[model samples]
Target: MEIAAAIQRRGLLFVLSSPSGAGKSTIAQMLLSTDDGIAMSVSATTRPMRPGETDGVDYHFVTDAGFDRMVAGGEFLEWAHVFGHRYGTLKREVMKVIEGGRDVLLDIDWQGTQQLKQVDPDIVRVFILPPSTEELERRLRHRGTDSEEVIARRMDRAASEISHWAEYDYVLINNDAEKCRELVHNILKAERLKATRRVFLHDFVRGLIG
Candidate 1:
């Protein structure tokens, strides 16, 4: 009988978070679309689905009770309440993707990133910042998706979120979309070459010596 090694080799978790209007989601989408080997971990949320959002694709749109059941079942790697909606990443799905040797990209907040790091210390956390507070507010208002009060709330939250930028392993200032995308791609390239991830290095060295 053949035996498999006990080692559980997996791809890295790439986490990117940012304040609203900082363009993290756009960059994440771009990265995932461009990189065939990387998949985005769609979160489960206790929020009503917006137009054009498919179930289990954009998100696992669930009710509050369903989300609670998942939490009770130990299904989430990290869960958090954002703007009154609970959002969580399913542990099983993410693990399956990673174990399949495809990197998983998580678009979450700083709190969620912290929880993920606790679960897997190999997670690479990236935080995106707006060029300036004024620019951030301008972008928020320009979107015209929210009312005056809601926009004000988002701006206030942005300030607090930006304050925690130092907590991330990498920081990208989204002043130019293309430039920020390139920087994020560069970060991913550098991370994938780390010694720990290059498990065949020892074998390669042995071959050279022999």
Candidate 2:
């Protein structure tokens, strides 16, 4: 049998998207918390600050005029208007992080993922889904923050959002949080091993052969 080629490690751009109550953000947080080499992409938004939110942390809160200026300058890698608010990722920041030999993670919506893919097809897109509609409703209600009317609206929106799961490269069902996190971790590890991304591998192999 022929010997398999060894691969090299390379930085990656990871995009994780999901509907409300699907646990995408939770999983993303866990991954980042566990991996020091991965950086979360901070988005710029036109939405008002919620309780305990800080500018440049949760988001770079900006006025509509500022957002417009950034868009006109083509500074955003991807952006979308969601729930009547605009959110976007800065292209330069993400590039800088990846170029520094670290993986960058984007917690965005389906629209933003699509836009990112258009700009960089190498982005690894993963979609998270709740196990079931009943389970999703239960999780939403369990939050205890939303009123009944708000919860109902969220459940309705979740159905429409999850229908686009097929558009993602990987679909993860959040049945067990630990298992789901492992699945995402495996995907990231595998993507980093792809030959095209690991350009240094060829040189190392040539050195060994010589």
Candidate 3:
């Protein structure tokens, strides 16, 4: 049997953070479609569902009271107020996936990433930036889901979000979607092969030398 197949490896929490309409979500979908080992972390949110979003898939839509109760109960690994709405990741859901040796991909904002980092320092954080502010506004308008007011709000917030790029492990300029996706995929592959993450290799090396 191959060494990779025989050895047990631990999984990591892979995070993707970006300003709205900056291609983080698009790249996340691309990765999900191509990578079988990683799964999206469906966050619980108090925000209303959008046109094509599914209940449990896109987000776990919850009432404000329900979200408050979960927060009081310490159910979330990280929670943040985003765009006047509350969003959070359930601790149990993420723990189950990662403990089973499967990666969990998080599409969240900078605040949530900071909180998650406090909980798990081993997480891999990646930030995506648009090629230009004009291009970002264009992408927001192209989505056609948000109103003019919301788009304005997102544009206003983009500068603040982009300022936090220095905090991430890796930062990518998403000028070309395919190229950016390839870069993100390459980062995942390399992180998975990191020496610190491959602790089981110690035992394998001992066996070979003995």
Candidates' lDDT values, in order?
0.86, 0.86, 0.92
> What lDDT score goes with residue 36 in model 2?
74
Query: Which is the leading candidate under lDDT?
Result: 3
Deviation in Å, model 2, residue 170 alpha carbon: 1.0
Which has the higher lDDT value, candidate number 2 or candidate number 3?
3
lDDT of 1 by residue, 1-210 (tens): 011111323478999999998999889989987787689988999988987789989999999999999999999999998877999999877977777778899999988988988988988999999998899888888877778988888887887888888999999889998889889988987887776876666666688899
TM-score of 1: 0.91
Best by TM-score: 3
- When 2 and 3 are scored with TM-score, the better candidate is 3
* Model 2 whole-model lDDT (C-alpha atoms): 0.86
Q: What TM-score goes with each of the models?
A: 0.91, 0.90, 0.96
For candidate 3, the TM-score is 0.96
Error of 1 at 128 (Å): 0.4
Error of 3 at 171 (Å): 0.5
**By descending TM-score, how would the candidates be arranged?**
3, 1, 2
* Cα deviation of 138, candidate 3, in Å: 0.2
Q: lDDT per residue, candidate 2, 1-210, as tens digits?
A: 011222235677899988878898889999998887689988999988987889988899999999999999999999998767899999877987777768999999988988888988888989999998888888888878677987888887787788888999999999988899999999988887788877776776798899
